[model samples]
Target: MKEVVYNSDLHFEHKQWNSELAFWEDELKTFKNRLSELVTRWTDKEVLAQLEHYQNQFILHGGVIENLQETIEKHETNIAGHSQKGDESMDVALVKKHSEFRYQMEAQRQIYADLKKEFFRFLSKYM
Candidate 1:
């Protein structure tokens, strides 16, 4: 029996990428808001300790977001590189690479979302 393969339409849609990019941008804004709240509310020693912990977590979250952004940029570069080549055979490879890149981008986006959720969870402890 041959295994069935599913290709998501998001793999080829510019709107999908734009939508995901917008999602992450909103997530970053939320993180900034939480960070501001933590800073404003840190008055006592216990709160300060919690604030320190959140500060570390925020740095780690920022790093993951940066890595995901870099992966997206790399995929864009790879697609651009392949598109510049005019050969039909290269187009086939470009399609394959684009699919793989989309999978990778989606995976990274999920990771970013998970990290954002974790950040919120950590912030909840202080609230």
Candidate 2:
């Protein structure tokens, strides 16, 4: 008969979590650079006009960016409150912190995607 074993010691190790976090961090950095490039390219009048159109459509969506900003701020406040309490379990605290960071990163990613779409749309219009 073959013996089967489960590695219980590997269950809670955070190495994988750390690796994923690092990967997302690098990806976020790349997204930031791409957004900056698009913004920089907006100096062209056609690009600016396209951006304005995009912004108008976005604004019609009830200030989506502002809502995202507010949600991020709320997450930050929750994290800060938890830190100030100083009595929560480390695991719980870490989860909250990680969630807050994830939320911020996701917000950035959304913005980057929107910007990239607008930039490409502008390019297509001019091409």
Candidate 3:
């Protein structure tokens, strides 16, 4: 039997995911600022190379976050349309999409977490 997914449940899940993404976006800003400060304080060739690498990674990650945000916004709009049309629960396709998004978000979170750990370990050397 197909599980019923109400609009309320989808909204709640999207909200939670949006909140997490926002937090990660803010953290990236903080990390970038710290990197700027570190660059200003030191000019060792190796350290500068590592810093540049992280800067690029953060930029890439930021783009990914933006893309995710836009995708979610579109999905929310779709949900709103369904609500307006009086759909009490998601269709199978919508349910599958949501499940796929959930998995994608989990993967992104893990990848970002690993990057954060690596960045911090590098900071430990000079900070």
Estimated TM-score per prediction? 0.57, 0.36, 0.97
Error of 1 at 19 (Å): 1.1
In the range 1-127, model 2's lDDT, one tens digit per residue, is 5332212212222334344445544544554454455667668876666656655554443344445445545544554565577733334444555556556656755665686576567657644
Clashes of 3: 0
**Superposed model 3: Cα runs more than 4 Å off:** none
On the 0 to 100 scale, the lDDT of residue 39 in model 3 is 97
Once fitted onto the true fold, the runs of candidate 1 whose alpha carbons sit more than 4 angstroms away are: 1-12, 43-90
Report the lDDT tens digits of candidate 1 across residue range 1-127. 5332222232346446756666766766777777778888777887777667656665665666566566656655654564466321234455566568678777876777676677768677766
What is the alpha-carbon lDDT for the whole of candidate 2? Answer: 0.50
lDDT of model number 1: 0.62
The residue-by-residue lDDT of candidate 3 on 1-127, one tens digit each, is 7668898999999999999999999999999998998999888999999999999999999999998998889889999999999996889898899899999999999999999999999989878
For every candidate, C-alpha RMSD to the true structure in Å: 5.0, 10.2, 0.8
Best by lDDT: 3
**For model 1, where is the 10-residue window of minimal lDDT?**
2-11
Order of the predicted models by TM-score, top scorer first: 3, 1, 2
| Residue 106 error, candidate 1, Å | 2.2
